[model samples]
Target: MTLNWQCIVVDCDDPRQLAAWWAELLGWRLTHAGDDESVLEPAEGSPQDGVSPDMLFVKVPEGKAAKNRLHMDLRPDDQAAEVARAEALGATRVDLGRPDDASWVTMADPEGNEFCILRAFTPEELATLE
Candidate 1:
């Protein structure tokens, strides 16, 4: 038996809008768009082509009421720049009482789903791991 991850589904009030926002942020293409859901996948031939799972944004009736049990943590080449870009695209910083020196910054999407932006690994630090 084998199981492969397909996609991460996110519940939002407006699937199209939310999906568009994410698509813009991640440079993913909108593979499908419908009344209730929108799907995004990395562009063909890109580094993330098959390794990264698709993102499916589905419409829901109720607004987000609590913190997300499962959230995404992104490691970018430049954490501060990425966070700023996300903010410019309508994402807001979220405070979960983390330490001031925490290596990750918590942020929420337009619909309030939380995700974190982790600090970039220095080349020397990455080399040591290998």
Candidate 2:
């Protein structure tokens, strides 16, 4: 048997808004926007365009009551700068009691969806993993 992963469905109060926010944050293309659902995809012709899964935001009446069981982990070239940019885009830092020296920073989107920003590996660190 074989399977294909199509998209990750996100439940939000406003699908359009949340989808737009994520599209901007990840630089993904917004392929569809409607009242009940919105979708985002990797840029056309990019390596991940068809290879990566899409994000599908769907409207839901209930609010998020707890931390997400599954979340995204993003690694950027500069951790601090990326975190700052996320804040500028309305994402807030979340302290989930992780240790101070933790390699990842927790954050929440405008609709309180939690995701992590992992620290980038230094050149020396990358070489060690090779």
Clashes of 1: 0
Reference-based lDDT, each prediction: 0.94, 0.95
lDDT by residue for model 2 (32-97), tens: 999899999998999789999999999999999999999999988899999999999999999889
Q: For residues 1-130, could you state the per-residue lDDT of candidate 1 as single tens digits?
A: 9999999999999989999999998899999888799999998889899999999999999999999999999999999999999999999999988898899999999999999999999999989979
The superposed Cα distance between candidate 2 and the true structure at residue 94, in angstroms, equals: 0.6
lDDT of 1 at 47: 89
Candidate 1: residue 15 Cα off by (Å): 0.8
Relative to the true structure, candidate 1 has a C-alpha RMSD (angstroms) of 1.4
